[model samples]
Target: MKKIAIGFGVLTGFLAFTAVAFAQTYTPLAPLPIGEGGTTPDTYTLSSYLVGAIKLLVAAGGAIAVLMLIIRGTQYVAAGINPSAKSDAKERIMGALIGLTLVLTSYLILNSIDPRLVEFNLTLPPVGQSPAAAATPVAPTPSAPAPVLNNGGTNPSAQPVAPAAAAPVTITSPTTAVTPLQNIINARINRSNDYSVISNCMGNTTYDLCVKTDLNGDGQTNLSDIVLFTQKGNLFDVNQNRVIELANTTAAASCFFKMPGANVHAMLPRENWNQSWSDGGSSAWYISGYSCGGSGGITGMPTVACSGATWIKAPALMNKCAITNGYMNMPFGFVYGGGSQFSKFQNWVTSSSVGSAVDLRTLFKATFFRPIASGDGIPQDEYFETDDGKLTYATIAEYDLNNDGTADFNASGADMTAFSACQGGSASGACARADFNQDGTIDARDLNLVKLMRNDVFGGSGFTPLGWILNWFESAFFDPAGYSDTQIISYCIGHAAFERCGYADVNGDHKIDNADLTAFNTGAPLLDFNSDGKVDLR
Candidate 1:
């Protein structure tokens, strides 16, 4: 027994000596690579020194743990006769293994929690000064929808569509009644094929499968066009399989084959075969890999799922209409001067017959406006506690009915009624009380109606005009400022009942009171974060 113990001690000493020698000679703990270009950190820096120290400590700890594990494992093997000794050795081995694992994986555990945890920046700011400002967080840009492409065909990104037919067919009536598929067919058939410039060929210009191929002239060329195309059973054979099967009904293929005046044959560097597209009465060029429909096996178009906000055309009178949502000054500002004001989801069709009714609520939801962090940006006076015990921006400001510096009193029922009447263009006795304090014209008055209500008049409304509001009325006909009394009054004429004209009934509850006040008094005006010519809110 004594000999065995002495032998074990010798072996342990030898192993420890070997580990130390190996570490000193090789220094296995290499400097960590850092930064974007994977360059090693400066050795003189405190962070680098600390990292080096940590790496050394971890390597030493791991070595010690492994050594202990080996010692215990040897003990367990040697103590074959004594069951109690073997069990104790086994437990010690397990403990050593666990310690080694922890030592080696400490960085990984910290990183898994958060990469910042393992990172350190010990550099201090200069004396009597704060640290340099961090980079500003940019709001994420929304991705455009992907194009629906056909199967068994290469993308015609650079290639032009086939040339015009030998006898170009001229569309007689632009408003002719035809199937949606025929609409696409007719437009493509009529477009003059320009090889050098593909502008005249208006088949899926953006190729997002949204509206460039508006064959029915509905302004929106979506799944409905493809559904109608498939329904008509006159789809262009994109895949030259000599058959227009259900498999060939890909959105990409549908638009690709029928591109007006596209020299598809010349552009494609492959073995070409001549195929013909017969749209009942006409024959056009169908390139290789496309096939005309066979007599059978044509089912219907597959059900496709598309997600986006539904836009409806509001009356042109709703242009540059500002609405107060109680909390912020003119938060729900809808500038519908034309479709050009919208950042996304613009009207595709310009027809007077198709009344585009835009969904204002959905449009605002997707927008990234001035977002306020909890208990930040808002003024102390503007803060109010909600019924749910949560503090938020005040919904309503103290109404100074008579445009005084100080708030007159809590807004009353008569005050709200008078304001509503004034909004309705009531020029008579009591309604005159609701009149805003103006120097001369309504243009000179505050653009922010809430500011006018609170009597918190500033030279400028403090709102930096964003895209939509800036160009709302920059047209040749209307006033450049877009704040003429005539324009504002004309806007208020029909929209007094609606919230569009900045009526005090912000919550749309009919009667304005304390609850309505809860939506007033945000310290700042509305924001247009993306500069997309529209006011947005998170």
Candidate 2:
């Protein structure tokens, strides 16, 4: 009876200790200030409290069992003449063992069922702030319904439809379908006053595909220009095979154009002028046996060359090539003859041609031919390719509103501010900046588009190209500034709400509840648990 009474007292003390520990409010050593309001006090969830109680119970039970064993061993030795005392000591030892086993067994069972049962979250965020605000200890809430996606993973509504046979090119006067190509051209054209020469071609409504070939200065892009362009092997085919390979490569391909210009050059598999004569000669040109230096050829002309090739001007060949390949004509003023042939092409079209006489920068656009369905029908002309090389409508409609040379989600407040400025506004030319669907208006539709792409990371993990550029420009060229802890917390809270990240909605069902504790422990690191800028549990 004495031993049983001792054991009960020990258990009661342990229970009291656990109760006190749980009831005590958590206090941070240095609490972070949130926004302009309150300090984010350290907080704990009910689940954490329960977990603490369980731990204390186990520790107390184990300690008592050890103490009982020691006492029984001592009593057994001392009670040499008293059998009753020996029996009592043995009973106490057995009881202690049984009780200890039960406590440990309960812990093991609960832990095995779910590690979260034993998990305790000590990190807490400030309350009553935006989704971007510091994280706070929140009880799990009810989960929301699963989000609906079109066509399982594919966006069928955004899929490009096949062009009708011999369909007349729709010509809306003064403007055409605001395509990715058009946007790129317009951006380049507006970047400099030197590009004024080609500004008239900005809104041309002649060809479904913009054509810049007026080789003879006839001011008309006829079939003759296309023939000349093809003859020069300038309109190279985009290697659909390479793009498909990239699509399967990884998520990075969805945003960055990884294929080198050389690979782009290799995309033209057919025998064309782009290829060297030694590999596979062009059928259009006959190789003459006579060398330019031999007898009948001119002093500077090549002896062994394509027949009648000298009759066509070099500028005409380049212009025709650009047009044939579904790009705008390369202006004569653009520097051409240095570096890798592909590099020269990129420079001539977009970068180096800035100060040149005739700037056709606005006319340059990438053309891709992607199949809509598997192994059926003709491949449709896709104007833009996503970083992953997918031919979806989202990829096509994506634009570089910030003019940072890459299209990606706007994650900063500055970007949001810019977007807000154009909302409910007239169809100013600036409309193209935020008008996602090119409907000539910036409204709810465009806002929703921004929301849809908020999580999109371009250039893959560890290397955010656009973000890096923006940061560099801000620090190096513009004003340098850093967000304070309060600002960071506020931004985090706002970001969570905007993205529907659900730090409190642990189950990801879009609600908070006790059930969510299970998900919170096991779920992906989608929230910033440690006040770091990144979304991670650690």
Candidate 3:
């Protein structure tokens, strides 16, 4: 096995060298020689990235401090310098403390220390892919639903479909999607690609996929376009038989001769490939042997059970002689053998439609008995995806449902999105109130018929309607700046309705009133650590 891997490496290296000799355009996913050009991007400025993060922290903190100062100064001026002023001073201190609370609270919620803190599992896109576009019919006409491809392992990537005799080169963007698959397909592709330039070409599987956005919509990276191939693979004729047959489906031939631009009706899991893919589509290109035992350790073949942080397209698998460059971002190495070709599933995506009326289904589950993760099987440790032009990252923490010790969040459920709305909103946000947009104030503008009943103003008006009071305040004294949560609670001090009598124990020292004032004055490290009018740290 050792000699075979070496020989295969040398042979593969020569073939790769020959292929590179041709001056062909490659996409962003273009693969490079193993020991050659591919490298982790040095574009991330270690120093500059850190500097920018520090700057954002300073800016957010500074804004909160300024607000606190304004609030404190306002109260001090309102009270004369006598005992009243001293009392007012204490009030100002509390106000500052509250402002600090908001600032530090927001920071704690948004800070994420690590990205790969979550675990991921080897996942494959089902054979199900977007159906042929109506604008272009695959094949001369519409061919019958293709059979489950015989590729070694079943992939739910591209559904089998035939483009018209001449299909126009229409596509989608990773950030913008006319169809959902376009989004998922493109997002995964863009991240998998380690190349510099992005192109859409057929042949080189490495950089074959491309992502485009703002296609007939506002320019955004929300769409995706998949590249079929722009590279070569060594596994086309698995059995060394020139004729690609059904029986050789699980062998390297499946990846090599897997039909392009068609939807498949079956799937092959990686476990069924019988460890043949290790042979590199072609045994000639495949590595001979490695120390693969009960643990399945084979030198030349891809570690069938190795987990890769990145995900690659199946069509991509077919491009290599018997090498894989990326993974599905999981902790466990998922295996697919001969009978598990993923090419079996059919994908149907629907745009301009919603609800049960329109169903986007994957047919692979129906054709084969795939042991899809029983319950969120993909380990979900935690992953980070930056938005806002990559300026900010959405901290996602995944929980491993299957306690095989693999803790990653690969499954999606309704509960998964429960905290989604709060992902960006602050405690001061409009959520949980009439303030749906999070601008701050709960007003008639947010909801045309909004009515806030200031129970204090109701006095003796029989039964004061809730909205009636809210409506009066907005029309009479409502001001955007006045809607600050800190201000609202402060105002409630003298009011009868919103009582904080016992709640005054902000310091949790178990005391009620005066101690709360002392705690506010001291500006404990938790709430007012930095205390420049407001606070940070805690």
**Once model 2 is optimally superposed onto the true structure by TM-score, how far is the C-alpha of residue 496 displaced, in angstroms?**
65
Descending-lDDT candidate ranking: 2, 1, 3
Q: With candidate 2 superimposed using the best TM-score fit, by how many Å does residue 214's alpha carbon deviate from the native?
A: 66
**Regions more than 4 Å wrong, model 1:** 1-43, 133-538
lDDT tens readout by residue for model 1, 1-538:
3433464476458435433331111222566574224566434344444445555666887788889888998999999999999999987887777667766676677544333344334554335543321111122222522233688453222122323463433433323334333343345432221110122123333323223334346765444544443332221111222222221111110000000121211211222334464778654433344222222221111111111112111111121111221221211223455322222212111111112221232322222122335342221111222211110001111122332212222234333433544564643464433333221222213224343223322222333223332112111112213232122223332222223333333345654343333332221011111223222110
Alpha-carbon lDDT, every model: 0.32, 0.35, 0.27
Cα-based lDDT at residue 512, candidate 1: 36
**RMSD, one per candidate, in order:** 38.8, 33.1, 42.4
> What 10-residue stretch in candidate 1 is worst by lDDT?
251-260
Query: Candidate 3's C-alpha lDDT?
Result: 0.27
The numbered model that scores best in lDDT is 2
Q: Which stretches of candidate 3 lie over 4 Å from their true place?
A: 1-113, 119-461, 464-513, 523-525, 528-532, 535-538
Q: What stretches of model 2 exceed 4 Å from their correct place?
A: 1-26, 29-53, 120-538
